[model samples]
Target: MVAPPIVTLLASLVHPAAGVLVGLGIGVAGGVALLVQTGTQPPLAPARSAASPARERLPLGLVGIVAVFATIGGVFGSFNVAAIATAEASGAGAASGLLLSAYSIGSVLTGVVVGAARLPGGPRSRFLVAGAVFGVVVPVLVLAGSLPVLIALAFVAGLATSPLLITGSSLVESIAPRRRLTEALAWPPTGVALGATAGSTLSGLAVEALGPQSGFLVTAGSAALGAVLTLATVLFLRGRAASADAGSTR
Candidate 1:
């Protein structure tokens, strides 16, 4: 959503392909700046032992589940494209930006709400619920008849994103081996990068082959898949907790 506007603006002045190049340039610059900033930061304290987690390290099953949800998060980028196309097709090109803005607004609100009030659930459970909610909301985008309505749906769909993201990372942090905390955190974004590439390509295809409205189903499906994985994670964790409890009693 953020890069597209820059691409469009630059493309109008240059070539479409060149716009992508420029966007990439900007991204590289920003990334380098971020790296420099982070590299300069000092460690808070001397290293210490990790809290005794449910495991020594994250289970492969848990890693896979987190990756699945991260992919669902990445699919939101595809939704922005599909939404923009739909808006332009409807002859309200001027309002197309609102779709992105509305979605972002929802994410911002999530940070605020999550910070201000505690939601009742672990990060994993909340992540599952958020994924499911977005799954249901994304499909409903097809039913939107006006630009405003589409924006509203986009906003609602975005409500789940940051919460899922924050919780997913927290879950990873909680389970990550002490020696590999940074490595564990890296997987979520890696999953996001792979998913975004695949999602944008597939979303473009779906829009071309299935029509813009139907293209949205891809994103919905991705979220639903994540929700399913999250549900399995929840069940697995519950079983572990129960087993641990029974053993303690014995």
Candidate 2:
């Protein structure tokens, strides 16, 4: 079935007042839910002092990295055409959509591959790195601008997203206290939303002030920062594990 035009319908139905009231009501309800969930049993166990946690506090780190990636995804996903809009490229918007879709398709395929394959150092560590590298590298390749290269980069960048997301979610499930699991789970999505909103809002100013070339550079920097953050998270997790092991041996 075709979806209703919710935005248009809502505009018609809520002459601003209804819209404000409806949004406020939803916000209030969501706040109540958050309070309820926070006070209840969380999903994680009481963190063991010397025992290895199935998931460490990787989510806290991954959330930042993935949110930046998600921002890039959203920028390339929706604003590519507008960002590149010039006499030479009138169809940039359409191209952006196609490119973002290709990127997403790559991510889905990669998730299947990573999920099924048993690689050394394991999926979380290996794939998280892979995802971060892809996040950094893709923007560089896109700036270089050969169609085949862009396509490949897009796919690789897209493929990396799922692993980052999966690992981030797993970390949330494994590390968060049972009472606060829902809040933990919400972080990545919240980051994604914030990132995308910021990217979309600022990208226009970036392109106007710095040009399209520099816009990619800014995005690349964001992606690189994300990678560094991810690596830092891994290091933090490893350090925690090592300390736990040493304590146990002592």
Candidate 3:
């Protein structure tokens, strides 16, 4: 979250190479710390027994979750390009870091509150609402006339992000089969990576052809698509739950 501003400041004070090296060092340190916590890691599940064969196909609900996550990643990628362009147009290229920081801060604060609070409704409902809000907020970015207003809107747009992401993960955990849990969990991140690449490329083109504001349209469209996909998958998720309940009753 704070990394963008810190890296930008470092780049301005030192050099771009210095900023990259510092970021790499921090990432390495964090990886090392995670590696050192091996003792606390959960034990791997035992191999499947002959009576319980591994499923070859993934659940439809899981695919929807991945698609939604991809949309979120699209927002992030498009915002990155739009923020830099907006800041440059305003004659303050470094201000892009501040904009990105505002977005991150909003997400972090919301995530903290969500983690501490016992929110009402099931994960699917919450995810739907979050996705809708995300869709609605992103289009407003096109209306931002000043840097300050853009920053504020960016923060507002970020408020829905954490809930959407956290709920998506929870849904994945609940829906995925135990045998392929690790592989299922990985799909969401893979979707995000693919979406980010596409978003960045398309947004760059939009910004170049139209303007920075047009870049936001890509994010808005992605968000709307995510919300629709979530809505469409609700029935599939409910069916999964119903099947699970029936199995348990037996």
Error of 1 at 45 (Å): 13
Q: What is the TM-score of each candidate against the true structure?
A: 0.77, 0.61, 0.88
Once model 1 is optimally superposed onto the true structure by TM-score, how far is the C-alpha of residue 160 displaced, in angstroms?
A: 2.3
lDDT of 2: 0.55
Model 1 lDDT, residue 18, Cα = 81
Decoy 2 TM-score against native: 0.61
Off by over 4 Å in 1: 1-26, 34-57, 241-250
What is the lDDT for 222 in model 1? 72
lDDT tens readout by residue for model 1, 1-250: 3454555556655776887898788889999898879665656745455863434465554666556656665566577668777878888765656777677778778867875777787766776676666556656766777778888988887676767677777777766666567778888887877777777777888889888765577677677677777677767766777888999999
26-49 in candidate 3: lDDT tens per residue? 999999998999786778867878
- Candidate 3 or 1, higher TM-score: 3
The 0-to-1 C-alpha lDDT of every candidate, in the order given, reads 0.70, 0.55, 0.82
Best by TM-score: 3
Give RMSD to native, each candidate: 4.6, 7.9, 2.6
Which pairs of residues have clashing backbones in candidate 2?
41-178, 41-179, 42-178, 42-179, 43-178, 81-92, 81-93, 107-159
**lDDT (tens digit, per residue) of candidate 2 on 50-86:** 6665553433444544554455444442234323432
* By TM-score: ranked, best first: 3, 1, 2
Residue 163 of candidate 1: its Cα lDDT?
Answer: 72
